[model samples]
Structures are given as structure tokens and as C-alpha cells.
Target chain A: MIDSQKPASAQDAEHHRTKMQKRKAVQDKEVASKTVEKGLLIVNTGAGKGKSTAAFGLALRMLGYGRRVVVIQFIKGAWHTGERKALERFEDLVEWHALGEGFTWETQDKARDIAACQGAWRVAQQALANPDVGLVILDELNIALRYDYLPMEQVLADIAARPESQHVAVTGRNAKEAMLEAADLVTEMTLVKHHFKAGVKAQEGIEF
Target chain B: MIDSQKPASAQDAEHHRTKMQKRKAVQDKEVASKTVEKGLLIVNTGAGKGKSTAAFGLALRMLGYGRRVVVIQFIKGAWHTGERKALERFEDLVEWHALGEGFTWETQDKARDIAACQGAWRVAQQALANPDVGLVILDELNIALRYDYLPMEQVLADIAARPESQHVAVTGRNAKEAMLEAADLVTEMTLVKHHFKAGVKAQEGIEF
Candidate 1:
């Protein structure tokens, strides 16, 4: 018998082998069915803090591939962030625009906010038109849209008009339903726990 | 007379200014209350992609600060992913260990899988002991736990036993409830759309 001299652990191994062989067959078949490829409109939105952080990470990944990426910060324009500083090393591949005047509340000037947004939008439009830019990250664009700083219709139109193979990543919380519907991929970052609630100040490299 | 000089857009701008001023005052006060500082246990989990991607991005940020970082990938050992190759460029500042036999189904040998995990665990424990490593990323550790490749209690205890100032990032899906309860920050990646369903094969750099 197969078990005549086999130890208990060996028998267990034999069972596992048979089980996994079946699983591999199933997974391989499933993976083989997928074949479509195209540029994606990726959205990062929710209550969690990493939406922008994740987008910047995607920006760095694209740069690692020798591709061009542009980051259009829709908020915190006046604040210098760690991602921006770190990406400087990849200057040839990364074009960053921390162009917001500030958050609308921080600036406290609606007219000025509108002017700044319009200017940023113009720059974004230019980046979208460029064929060489592989990815366009509209950082915190959701916050701008939430406050009605920019017209949603205009924003959607611009995104729609971008090059076919140009990937776009939009980040911020409370993304409009329309934005979600328009996206090819959307990730809602759900906050399970936050250190900020425990009076932990945002760390420099980690938080920024 | 007022309308003669001020257009409707100007009137809207004035309204926005007042609203934002009040918001700014409230936010500034709320932000001032947070002041504590301590290391955190960060968890990235869920069915969607980017749990590991976001964690790696976080690791890069830590490395940017000239801090040492280590990544212990507990699954997909046979797969030489693009991220691994890209990260190798930061060899001086980063240590990566892809120590799995393969995925559970592919390996189909529970004993061998357990041995690989235990080996990775030893490396992880050693890294956790080193005070110089700022961040320790236990990539795919959850999958091993899910499959009973390692004891959950041992994993949790080891994490709890890390250096007081050391930050740990655990990535995978179906994280144990106890792990989430112990974490300082947790983000669940909720997938709204995946191109994989559209038959898109994993592309290098982007998928890896």
C-alpha cells in the first residue's frame, strides 16, 4: 500500500500535493481567460489617508519603467510634500505641479481659489494633451470637486479627451458618483484605525 | 449701483470666501489638538489590489529618508516580480527576502510550505531585532496564516515583540481579526473595477 511505510507527515504531504494540483489547474485556466489591455482611469477615494500617497506611489512605479508621469496637485499647493521631494531624483521622468493655492479653507478666498484652480486646470489640460506623458495624477482633485471649485462636467470632459493609452489617477475623499462611474478602476480606502485620533502628529517621511 | 461693478461671478466669489474662512478657523483648531508621537502597526488588507503596492510605496518613502527598510515576501517565491527587480536598485537601503516555495496551490506540500515560512520567520525576527531597520514589511504574511502555514499566535506575538520605535507594515487579504484589533492604522482596499476581469494580462512594472 502507498501508506505501508509512509510517515504521517508524508501522508499529509501526499494529500496536499493532490489538492494543489487541482487548484493550480483551476487558477491557470482562470488566468488564461483574461486578455484585454488598455490604459485605465484609476480613482483613489474614501475616508482613509493613503489615497494620494498610493497615487504618488503609482507615479514612482511608472517612472521606474522609464515612463513619464505628471502630478497635478489640486490641493496643498502651498505645502511641500515628501513625495514631491523624493520624486525630484527622477526629475527626467517626473513633472510635478503642486499648483493649488492651498485648501479652500486654508486660503479662505473663493475668488483666489477659483483663479488658482482654473490655472491648474489649464496646466492639467496641457499635460493631458501631451503624448509622451504616460500617467496624469490629479492629486486631491476629489476635494476640489467636493467643494465645487471646478465644474464636474468640464473635468469629466477633459479626462475623456485624454489620449487613449494615457493612464490617469485621481485621488481624494468623497469622490462624486459620476467620477466612480467613469473610472476603469476605483479603490475606496477604508480607514480601520487612525493614529491621528490618538494624538499622533503626522510623521515627516511616513505621513507626508 | 453695486451690480454695475460686481458681476454674478464676483458675488459668488464673495460668498465662497466667507464660508471658507469659518471652515479654516475650525480646522486649524482641530488640527492643533493632535500632538502625540509613536511607532505604528500599519495593516493593508482586502481583496482588491494595491495592498502590497501601497505598502511598498510606503517603504520607498521610508527609504527616501535614508532609513533602512526590509521586505519579507512570504508567498510567490518562484515568481521574480518586476517590483523586486526595480527595488534592487535601492539595495544599499533595502533588504528583500522572497522566501516562499510558491502559492499554496502550486506548492501543494504543506510541510515544505511550513518550513519555508518558518525560515522566513527567523529572518523576520532577526530584522525586527535590528534597531537600524525603520520599517519591516511582512508582505503576504497573511496568506501563510490563512493557510495555517504558521501559527497565528506566534506571528502576533512576534509582531508585538518588535522594537518600540520600529514600524511594521503587514499586507495581504483576510487578515486575522486579532491583527486588525492590534493595528494602529488599517486600510482596506475596496475594488470597484479590475481590468483582470476584462481579460487584461498582468503587465510588467504595472502589475508586479
Candidate 2:
């Protein structure tokens, strides 16, 4: 009954199975013990590129379940993004506000950036208060926090006071330590390598 | 013309407008110079949890633009993922094949696992051959490669031979050096914190 050409041994497989069964038991028990249910404060930050993209994907997942979602853009409001165009088709399910003037470096004015961030925060607070919105994505909010465009204490307090059942996602680079500490889930995107450094130009559909 | 309560300075606003105009010109030039259009090999790897989620998000982005996409799950076929159920609404736009039996440790049979991976690779190769498929997501492929379930050289060769304009996303932990070398863009996810370690269980509609 031995298959000589296979990549793994039968004995190895059986041993793995036993080990996994035990692991599964532990995993199942661990998973079961997590009974706490509440809205999550998710932070996607670091030098990697998918923080905002991942947040947008979560938004899309929410929309798939027919839940209403609101996205308040803090920095990437200048260009038309693929996510924005795609979500527009789900007009009935998504409320998108591309509120920022543009990237901070492009604007080069701290005062204006802070003002734009504050403007977005007002709208986000309203989204947080609305029970109809199941998910609120504070896109690139971390950039504003990094630049002190909005007071960290106020942002933290506002997020903490969000509706019990409403989930919130914050994305950007160099997220504040306070924000990270308060997050239920924190994913740091590390840049192993980027195509931009290799002289590869950004494609419209892919980059934006 | 300066309002004390305004978020933006009138002068600053004008300066930003001029700056954006110049920046747009430069951006347009950079974009124009990037005329080479071809399929991209994107890799998401590391200890972070959003690798597959990010890849799925990329798939959703393609679906948003009305392009057909394919997702072939390698190590998570046993459980019913929220994404699999959610993608069902886009019946015509998506082709999701959860081909794995389960995690390798659970099955414990290396021969069987290798055969399963080989079978799935054949299916994936067909998906790659299809010109209409805009994106192909090889979910958890690194796991199969890690365990030597499938031949890595064959996998890389197949990916390289894919249609010129199609996009391929491979997600998992500990991706091989060859895979990373071949990838056009790579994002390494670093796990800063996970609820599982905090005794948090997986929740329905959230983790699944």
C-alpha cells in the first residue's frame, strides 16, 4: 500500500495527523473561549503598501454581507482610486467621502493639512454615531495623526466611544503608539521590496 | 480674506492649487513614460495576518472594475470562509475554487497532500491560460511550496508563462527566495498583535 513516488511518507503523515488533532483541540478551545463581542478598533500601519488596500477590502467584505459602509478619506482624495470607482457601483451600500485635498507633501502646508483632517474627523464622528453604518473606514487617518492634524486624545476618545456594534478601521504609515495600544488588531506592513525603487512606474489601475 | 475659523489659509490654498498644478504635470509625465503594460506577479508574505485578506481585497478590486477573477485556495478548503460565501453574489464575475482538503497537519498524508496540490495546480494552470481572467489568486500557495507538496520550479514557470496582462497574487508565510525574486511587488506583513494570543476567539462573519 506504500506509494513510493509520493513526496511524504505514510508514517510521517500519520504522525502529523496526531499532532494536528491535538493542535486543533487547543485551537478550538482557544477560539471558543473568546466570547467577548464588540466593535473592533483595527489599525493597519507600517512601511508596507496594503494598509489602505486591506481596509478597503474589509469594507468590500462588509458590503458583500449587504451591510452599509462609510469611507472617509484623509489624505488620498486628490486622485481617483480604483476602489472609489468600484465602490461607486455599490452606491446604495457605500457612502464615500474623498475629503482630503491631497497628499501632505503635495500640499506642503501643515495648516491646510490639519484643517482638512479636522474636516474629515467631523464627518467620521457622524458616521461613528450613525447605527446604520456598520463599518467606518478612516482612510489614511494615521497620516493626520502623525502630523498632529487632529488631536490624538480626541481621536482616541471618539473611537473608544463609537457605537458598540459598529466597527472602525484606521490605516496609514507610522501610526501613533497610543493608537496601536488601543487597537484590537494591529497589522504592520513591512516593505521587503518595492517596484518603485526598481524604476517601475505606477500603473493607473494598480497604484491608484 | 482670512477667516479665523477656516481650516485652510486663503493664501495657502492658492499656493497648494499652484503646487498641485505643477505636481500634476510631473505626475502625468511619469505616468505617460510608464507605457509598458504587462501581468504583475505580486507577493504577500510574512508573519502578518492580512496577506490572504489583502490578496482577496485585490480580487475584489478587480471585480469592482467588472473584470473576471479566479481564487484557488491551497490550505483553507475545509472551512467555509466568509469571502467564499460573499463572492457568490458575483457569480458571473468570479470563479472561486477551494481545492484544498484542509491544513496539511490535519490530513497528515504527504502523498495525498502532494497529489491534491498537483491537482489544484493543473486547475490553476488552466485558469492562467484563460485570457479573460484578469487576476488569479493562489491563496496559501507558499504553504504547499513550503511542505514540498508541489514542485516549486514548475509553479514558477507556470506563473511566468501566464498571459501578458493578467495579475497573479500569491499569499502565505515564508515564501521561497525564488518566488520573491520573481515578484514585481512584495509586501511582508508583520504581526504586531493578534487577538488569538490575547485569548480572543474567532468570530462569525469576522474571522471566517
Candidate 3:
């Protein structure tokens, strides 16, 4: 009765179960094989939104684990953002810094721009050196490197010299090839479509 | 003397300032032209990480404004995650639900998977229908839709029927073309490089 009276759905279900059991075993083996652990340099770059936002998400996660999280914005000015307000609630574990005046065009002063980048980099270097800080986010550091405001070679060296167990997340568009090579993980946020193109203004609590 | 005695760097700086001033004028005008404001149908999809992480980031932003943010995970099981722990801190403004047992392969049971999707959809429907839910995140709903666990037409209809000012963020890979067409913003997280490829295990407070 169990075999002869089985419905089509039951047969299909049994087939699926068998296939899945085999797949799960292979996946479990593969997962178990991965045993290395070290600090990771994560890069979030591309033309789409959420590079910094995703970094902030990682900050939240790191903070959740009762670790120190430092965010240093390189190109974005000290704008009022919802993430800032929310993250500041975890004041004990969060160190927030908005070091730039805005984008390069917004700042316009080449000397001042370079000076700001240098200042931000100093702060970033300190965070990177700190073994106690679980995650250090150099927000929009790529733009500074792209504009030659900071030496890419020195930045990469500083990242390499960071604490072995401290993760760093760098977010921006046009991440330097050298930076990408140095990164353990890189995610390019591709812009499939944008609401700003559709004349949707950046709203509070959403765009920020 | 003002022009002839000027240093090369100063002259270059002046040129850059003039160029930037003109550019800023155009940008300001364009920004001012965007007057329309409404809820955004945002989609985060692709073959990379952070699709769900970015959604949680948005949830955090929404919660900053004392607004309600509901996250309904459709494909992910009730796994212990750092984002869940941190977001739960804002108990009054957040509603978290992890309805699926795991991925399709992990579950294997077609009937059970479909039932889980339906249950998740019901929860999502309630949040989407409510105007007070500033942002409703349909996490991994694309995977459920990709597998035909839920009717795409009905899902889209419910999203469209939501209140005018209720924002919705749908996250997963391989989002439907129809959904893309209906979305105000769509970001595809492209995997350039992944740490997992290097046999780096998913560490707590990082991958989770």
C-alpha cells in the first residue's frame, strides 16, 4: 500500500527530499572545511546606494556583540542622518565622525579638501591600530584616494598593519584597484534603477 | 600683482573653485526641482551579500524617527543573528519575524515550504496594509516568489494596495522583472569578491 497507492505529489516530495538530503550533506561538508579566522577588510563600492548604509548595518552587528565600532566619514559632511541618530544611542560602543565638508565639488577648496582627508585618515589610522575596536568604517575613503587627496600606498599599508582581529569596512564609488586587491571581501552595489532619477527627492529618514 | 604674483597652486585652486561653483549651481537647481514625495518601493537583489543587511540598515533609519519598522523573513529560518539582537533593542518600534525553516534545499518539503511562505505573506500583508508601519521589509520574499511558493500577482497587488505613505523594502536575489518595473529604486549587489571563497568561515558578528 505504501508504494502502489502513493500519489504523484508524494512521489515528487520523496524525490525532492532525497535530492535535498544529498545537497545538504555536500554543503555541510563544504562549510565544515572552512576553518580560517582573521580580520577582514570589506569594501563596498559602486554606483548604487547603500555602500555606507550597509557598513552602518555591519556597525550595528558589531555593536550587538559588545564590541567597539568606529565610523569616520571622509567625503560626506556632517549632515543630519537618521542612522547617526539611531547609532548614537549606542554611545558607549560607537565613535561617529563626519570629517568632510561634502563632496569635492561642494567643498571646492583643493587645499582644504586635502587637509580634511588627511585629518580623517589620522583618525582612521588610530582606529585601525586599536585592537579593542572590532570594526572601523572608513566611509567614502575611496573618493579621497580617487582624487589623490591621500596616498593609496600608505592607506593600504596602514590597513595591512591594522590589528589582526579588527575588521575594516571602506565604502565609496570607484574603489582603487590596489584597495580591492587588499580587501578580503568586495561588494559592488550596482544601480539597476534610482528613484532620484524619477524626481523623487531625498527624504528624511529614508535617503539619509 | 594680484594676478601675476599668484602661485600655480593658488591659480589652480581658483579655477577649481569657479568650475565647482558652476557645477553646484546646476546641482542645486536640479535638487530643488524634485518636489514630489511618496513612499518608495525599494528592491535589493543580486548575487552578493548585504541585500538583507541594507534592508536592516533602512529599518534602523526608519526606527530612528520613532516610526514602526516590521521585518518579515520569508526564506531564512529563525537563526540567531546579530542584526536581530540589535534591532530588538528598539522593541517598541520593531516587529521581527523569521517564518521559514531555512532555504528550499534545507527544508526540502514542498508543501511545508509553501505553507511557510503563505504564513509569512499573511504577516507581511498586515504590515503593508498598516499606514503606521513606516517601513516593512519583506526579507528574501524574492526567493519564495522565485520558487513559486506564493502567487506573484497577489503579492504585487498587496504591495500596491498598501497606504500611500507606507514604504516597503523587498530584499532577495533574482527579483522578478515585473517587480523591478514597479519599483522606485533597485540595487543589485554584485559579488566582486567574497571571503567565503577563500575558505574563511562565516564568523559570529560578521557573516551573521
**Interface RMSD, every prediction, one decimal place:** 2.1, 3.2, 1.4
TM-score per model (chain B): 0.91, 0.87, 0.95
lDDT of each residue in A91-207, candidate 1, tens digit only: 787898878977778887776777787888999999989889888999888888988889999999999998877889998899999998898888889998888888877776678
Ranking by DockQ: 3, 1, 2
- Listed in order, the DockQ scores are 0.56, 0.41, 0.70
Which CAPRI category fits model 1?
medium
lDDT tens string, model 2, B1-208? Answer: 5456666667666666677678777877766766566678999999877888788777767776788889998887865366676677678988988888887756666677788888899989999998999999999999999988888999999999988889899998999999999998899999898766766666544566
Model 3 over residues B1-208: C-alpha lDDT tens digits? Answer: 2476889878889988988888889989989989878899999999988888888888878877888999899988754388888876788988989998887778878899999999999999999999888999999999999989999999999999999888999999999998899899999999999998898998877887
lDDT of 1 by residue, B65-177 (tens): 77788989898785436456546667797898989877889878787888999999999999888888889999888888888888888888988888877889998899999
Better of 1 and 2 by DockQ: 1
Put down candidate 2 lDDT per residue, A1-208, tens digits, no spaces: 5456665655577666777788878866766887777778888999887898888777767776777889999997865366777777678988989889887656766677778888999999999889888889999999888877899999999889888878898999999999999998999998888776666676645666
Candidate 1 yields a Cα-based lDDT of 0.81
**Which candidate has the top score in DockQ?**
3
Q: Which residues of candidate 2, in runs, are more than 4 Å off?
A: A1-8, A108-110, B1-35
- Best candidate, TM-score: 3
Runs with alpha carbons beyond 4 Å of true place in candidate 1: A1-8, A78-80, B1-14, B78-80
lDDT of 2 at A152: 95
